[model samples]
Target: MELRLGISTCPNDTFIFMPIIHNFVDTSPFTFRVVLDDVEKLNGFAVKGILDVVKVSYGVVPKVKNKYNILKSGGALGYNCGPVVVSSGIFTVDELKGGKIAIPGENTTAFMIFKYFFGEDFDFIPMRFDKIITAVEEGKADAGILIHEGRFVYSNHGLNLLADLGELWEKKQSAPIPLGAILLTDKLKKEAKLLNNIIKSSIKFSRNNFEIVKPFVYRYTQQLDDDVIKKHIELFVNEYSLDVTPV
Candidate 1:
């Protein structure tokens, strides 16, 4: 059976799925036609229930729970791996109140935690995650929430971090931050275990054969250097990538 699989272009997603994309694993009776896009777009797709499988912000779970069953493997959840709020100018957390902020998406986990962290008093401008840092730098926004590689590179753009949402969540909730998760539509509910295993195997294959996977990752994110790409994968794809249970 063929499945429509949706994922982001982020390094962790690319790294985990490289083996599956390159046919380096045993995926009998199943072939994935992957749709690579931003996490917000994937979240929109999940809300619409268009894909057989997808990676989406964990914040979208409440919206798509009726449509999909979340799988344990192939997810991004860990400590110190959450979105960061950044700005070109220094602003105290209180000063950011009522200021205009650029966000990845209204439905993203980042936005959810952002609201929980800063309260619901700020004006949120929803945009593509990749454009947030630039928007902040250009004075289009008072601050922006940075996810994926943005969490690492925002300082390079002369942005100051106002808050690390992950740290806030950990301190307040005392748990790892859940950034994203893999979901399988209810039509394939019976196959959730099989699909989860396939995803876990793909992650394991990529780890053991990283040389073969690195070029694929670099190809998709050519703007990021080797170290950034590696760091992105190392930070996001951890013990949780194989299963959602916190270690």
Candidate 2:
């Protein structure tokens, strides 16, 4: 069967999925029709039950639990790798209360973390993840919660770090932060193990053949700096991505 697959265009996602999408791995039991979009868009697709398999924020799991099952492979989870809150000027966490903040999406893990840290007291404007830094820099919002490559390059946009949500979570929960996850709908449940292995194989293939997947990563990254792209892949595609361990 050919499954409808959805994933983000981020470097870590592109790097791990390049081999599978390009037929470098043996996708024996199933073939994929892929759709690449921003991670938040993928979450919205999940809510609509539009894809057979997708990468979505873990925060979206509860809302779409009936439509999808969390896959054990192909996720972004780790230490010091969570979302960051940034602003054009210095602001304390206490001062951020009731202030305007730009978040990637209401359904994103980043947004969930922000809520966990600050509660429902802030004015949140949901925008594209790539736009949050600029939104803060331009004073459109008092601050922005950044995910993916935004965390890496926020300083270049002249943004100041307000808090590292990942570090905060780690300190409080003493667990790895769960960012994005691979979710397979119930229709694909029987093939879950097989699909998981295929995803694992794909990530392994990409790591061993980095040069082969580099161009694909670059293509979706909007021509980001080569070093930044490499750093993104290194930071996100780790053991947690290969298998979902307890968080």
Candidate 3:
């Protein structure tokens, strides 16, 4: 069977998927045609039920639940790994009310968290995740929610963090903050267990053979230094990526 697999270009995704994409791990029973884009785009694909498998924001799962079932492996869920709200100048979380803010996407968990914390009173301008820091730095928006590598580099752009949405969720909930999830459509439900095992093996293979996967990681994240890229992978691809059930 040929499966359409969609994932973000973020370091964690690139790292965990390297072995599978490179055929280093056995991906028998299915051949995958991959689509790489930002997480929000993948979420959109899931919403449209265009892809057989995709990495999507956890916020989108409920909306796409009828079509997609959350997979047990290859997801991002952890503490202190949530989106941050940043601005060019110092501001409190409460002060952000009624201000224009840039978010990664409307369907992103980051945006959902922001709304949960601050409500819909503010103007939310949705843009690519990487563009959010620049949008705030340029005054295009009063503040922006930073995710993925943005969390690592926002301060370098002179952005001030007003709130850590993930921390808030952690305080309120017992479960770790679920940023993204791997979703497989109901049409493929019967094969979900097999696909989950394949994903788990891929992640284990990549970690055990880090040097072999390092080149692929660097290739997708050439703009980020080796240290940032490594940290990005470490922060996002935790035990949850291998199995989300326990998390």
Candidate with best lDDT? 2
The weakest ten consecutive residues by lDDT in model 3 span 218-227
Candidate 3 or 2, higher lDDT: 2
* TM-score: model 2 vs. ground truth: 0.97
* Residue-by-residue lDDT tens digits, candidate 3, 93-141: 7787788999999999999988887799988899999888888888999
What are the per-model C-alpha RMSD values against the true structure? 1.2, 1.2, 1.1
In model 1, the runs with Cα more than 4 Å from the true position are none
- Estimate every model's Cα lDDT from 0 to 1: 0.89, 0.90, 0.89
- Candidate 2 lowest-lDDT run of ten: 222-231
What is the C-alpha lDDT profile of model 2 across 70-165, one tens digit per residue?
888999999988999988876676788888999989999999988888798989999888888778878899999989988888888888888999
Cα error, residue 3 of model 2, in Å, equals 0.5
Write out the backbone clash pairs for model 3.
Answer: none
Clashing pairs in 2: none
TM-score for predicted model 3 compared with the true structure: 0.97
